[model samples]
Target chain A: MKRRTALKVAASAALTSVLTIGSAYGAEPIRFGAVAPKTGALAAGAAITHWPNIQLWVHQVNERGGLRMKDGSRRKVEIIEYDDRTNPGETIKAVERLATQDKVDFIVAPYSTGLNVAAAPVFAKLGYPQVAATAITDKIPELTQRYPSIFFALGSTTALASSVADVLAKMKAEGKIGNRIAMVNVADAFGIELAEASRPIFVKAGFEIVFNRSYPLGTQDLSPIVKGAKASNPDAFVAWSYPPDTFALTEQSKIEGLNVKAYYTAVATAFPAYGGKFGKSVEGHLGAGGVNTDTAEMKAYFAAHQKVTGKPADYWASAVTYASLQVLEQSIEAVGTDRKAVIEHISKSTFQTVMGPWKFVNQSIDKVWTVGQWQGGVFHGVASTGLPGAKPVIVKTGW
Target chain B: MTARETRTLILVVVAFALLACLPLLRHGYLLSLGVDIAMYTVLATSWALFSGPTHYISLATAAFYGIGAYVVAAGIGTLPYPALVALAGLAGAVAAALVGLATLRLSGVYFVIFTLGLAELVRQIVTWVQNNFTGSRGMYVLTSITERMIYWELLALAAAVFFIGWRVARSRLGFALRIIGNDETVAAHLGINSAACKLALFVISGAFAGMVGAIMAPRLSYIEPSIAFTSELSFQVVIMALLGGVHRLWGPLVGVIPFTILWEVIAARFPTQTVLLLGIAFLLIVYLIPNGVVGRIESALRAAQRRVSHA
Candidate 1:
């Protein structure tokens, strides 16, 4: 009995030792938590513009045998994802759970301005360098001034808003567009802000606002509004819309045959499905864009994105996500595992990403804004004039 | 406490202790799970108050919950965190009481519509406030979030909500609510003052939801129209209460824990199929387990005891 007991004890000890060494051999994987609206109203936009770049980065990094860690070792990057159901409260709760509960080394948030706003303070407080991919509002920079840890990937709204006016001016000077303009805005925070900012600039540049209307944000039917626009007989129709609202308004406008002279929208203008949905109808449709189609680097990125995701990758927000990822990698490379150090580095340093280069100018530097518009199925960079192959597309009036 | 009461208390205490230790467990993932459960626990218990007692379906709980949250965000500049949270609860209670007075006259479906109207109104008000307060830029609390702080705060709020539920269940108010629940007209005939009781219940329940909102708003560090108030949230609370068992004291906790875990699992595992599955599961629960899992379990146990005694 004593001999049998000794043998069993020895066997147990051996098993424990083996388990300990096995755990030691397996280095802990670096986990990054991503939260986005996988369902609900935001899902369609998220599927097209937001999710693929994350999967792209994950696959690319993993293909190279994962990220190189500080200890001269490589660990696979594990992504723990949650669908926020397009609810801000749920997104906030998910982000908190992901940060504090999941204890992810990094976090990638969704493309909603409201959701990003909800998560910014959480990420900043935890000292996590959150790459807020698509959602860009003027409020982000103001928040960044107070909390230096949060950095925005997308171009500031102030730039896009005023630049739309500048783009209209350039088109008007070319004698390709009419003098009359009309505005229709969704009555949400983001839409309202964009419309308000774009209005003064549009007026200052000699564009007349003939008809203006603000509909409630979730108004599913826009035929009445579009019919009213048709009655006004404006040359250009400028709409400030959310993603779902964009599709609804655009589809309804087409149905009503209220094409007018030029059709333009904000938010999901650069979506591939938008083009695929309308075909020729969307060819001349204009909106905000971040990158140009002709750039070799952008082309390569899109090609890679298409190869990996099996979906066309040419939206403005995805460019922002791609740029944010580049910035994140650069920050991690500079600061190594220290989150505070990374935040400080980002605050002080100008990092080169796919968005050309971004420097954290004084929280007051609102002048370096940019805007882009689509023409012939390609988005043309309009503002900040030095970009290559960025000749302005002037819209000629039928009236 | 009696033997049965003592055993129940011990079980509850042990469960809470496990929750408290979860943040310090092997991974932060577990901590997040704990936070989700804790938040649901608060929401579930508050939802149970009106649904279980008076049977007056207050779908406007989400509105009050959101009001409490935004009030905290709006008051953060002026009030301390604890005071701000308390004030939010006070505000929610007042709003609930006022709403109860207006709608308590209705019954069944009409009551449901009245509450729905209140929720829609609250959503509109939230949008208007966001537009005015933040200059049409979404209202974001310009602050950083700390995990440990929010975890502890949520835990405290959860405890406070459960405590309120426990006190109400054990007090004279419980008997009054039970009478009202059997039939409001009959309860009023017995001088139960159904309107007064409902208003008080609304105030109490609204305060619990408000407390949760106050704690959660600061954690998110941002608030907007859709974030603070949504019909979906009201439905979630109601579902949680139904899953737990409407009349039973322990139903909310039972419902919240399993529902939250299942919700996370579905989200993490299936990702795309979660909503469809949740809908299907809700349908099944409504059909298969009408009184909820806990209520069914209790009934089964009682029948088994009777069989054993007869034998």
Candidate 2:
């Protein structure tokens, strides 16, 4: 009697699951593919900005029973992942694998500026919409024209660099700061692009770049650099830096008491640790990447990100990455797995995301935060091309 | 020519014919893998041509490779593709000759250190130039060349490298280099111009590496100092040559195929731990096959012949 009851229970349980799933959505899962630098120089950055966002997007989509189809059927999303080892060759290979070997329905952009640029042609040839979020280069106008299917969410190097100059120029005009400024950059693609783009803009804004030097990316002791910048006695200091160097420079600035009204660093300035470590000191500190975290929706996003990834979403490109996914998901939902149609839809439609309603004009983001400031404990939006919800710039009282 | 040389010539021709048709499958992944193997084969074979006979263990493969790529990137629109490739090869040869003349006096660890530093030194100089002049970090290579085109060019380059290596192995320079590799002082006493022979072979090796780099620049789509002259590439080429056996012209081929497939599998299976797994795999290869698979297999065959004669 006991054996018969157990068998009957298993049959009914299996029958119910099959009936429900078959009735609601009988289509195969849409296989989404992604590549990131899970191991290498950008591994830490990828962990914070790339992989976790992908996971969260996948979870959110599945929570809604995958994407709703055109035929009143729903297909679940199944993700195929690859770690590019932070090598461009590997990135190309992994993307090719996703397109040819695995036959995934879509491919997400690789992380970092160099890598996204490296893998752009592969994505283009394979007919995948390359929505790059973390990549920031000044050559977007040329790149987008060259690769029709590629898109850039992060603003250009010229836009960000000029924005910094404009902000500092406003300070000088207001008599809040002098025309003299000190600048340092880590000698890599990101740092070099920003630093070089800023030079002309700084000159145009009538600012003298008193101390401009570049140290290698992983330089341990920033004392000499700090000493040189301090000797220049500028009213502002800026560092076009990556994460490790950002933290090192900030710590070194604090140690050396390099007092300046406008202190800014790039990349990792949006990281929660920047605030956690510097706390009250980071107030009025300006950096790249900003978010208006006052809204209920933005708060919910932060909560969900923390809950899912066990870390706060970075104030910089993390939202831009997620917003790109939202755009991708919506496009795929409207027009099945047709790559061309999906690209067309994304190119045409306005997407309402955590960052707000926006559309790509000429295959580029219409608006993006050029710079963000640390106000109180949040990374508040201080400037953008759109200028929506931008907070007033605050003066820094030495770290 | 000896029967062995004729056999190797025919076998290399057959291998080239087989590899050139892989892109016909119309599969991106397979074609990319073919590109990987052919690129590595050329790099390792050419590297062994100089380093194997001299036992110099030069790690400047990346330096030449980067020079080749940068040459193409800088001169793409100004010159034709073939011209750029030739110019890249010439540039590499000239650079190699200069470096070899200056640093050939050092040997063993000092030579290794110099060659290893060469890549970084080149990278730094390139960075400084770009920073000061172009106001950009990297340049984009927007060309009509497809992946299939790259694969074919690389395969053709591989064949050319193998043919040159085969000829050099039978040449008088090869004999002198063998003596120099065994004992440089002894070779000098025997009236061998050891320095010139080494420099000649080094130039040839560098030229091949440069051409390969030019062919591969489009695959990366962009060229930067760090990407063009990555240190990992130099070490990877060394590992491939060592694994195949530097003593023979065909040894690096013996190493490149297995390592390429094993790497693809490891990358897929353990994506997050690729570096760690790669370390473990290298350790195993070194421990089990120190003299390389080809050398070990050749020795084993000779031992079997000896046993048969005794019986």
C-alpha lDDT values of all predictions: 0.74, 0.89
Question: Across residues B189-229, which tens digit of lDDT does each residue of candidate 2 receive?
Answer: 99999889999999999999899889998888778777898
Q: Which residue pairs show backbone clashes in model 2?
A: none
User: Best candidate per TM-score, number?
Assistant: 2
Pairs that collide, model 1 = A101-B28, A101-B29, A101-B32, A121-B145, A159-A369, A176-A395, A176-A396
DockQ of 2: 0.50
RMSD of each: 6.3, 4.9
Q: What lDDT tens digits, residue by residue, belong to model 2 across residues A1-399?
A: 999999999999998996686466567888899999887788899999888989998998889888888887878887878888788999999999989888899998899888999998889988999999988887798889888888989888888988899888998999889988999998876688889889889998999999999998679999999999999998999999989999999999999999999999988899998999988989898899898777676788889999988898999888889888888888998898999999899888888888888699988995999889999899988888884889989899867
Q: Model 2 - which docking category?
A: medium
User: Cα miss at A32, model 1 (Å)?
Assistant: 4.4
What's the true lDDT of residue A72 in model 2?
Answer: 79
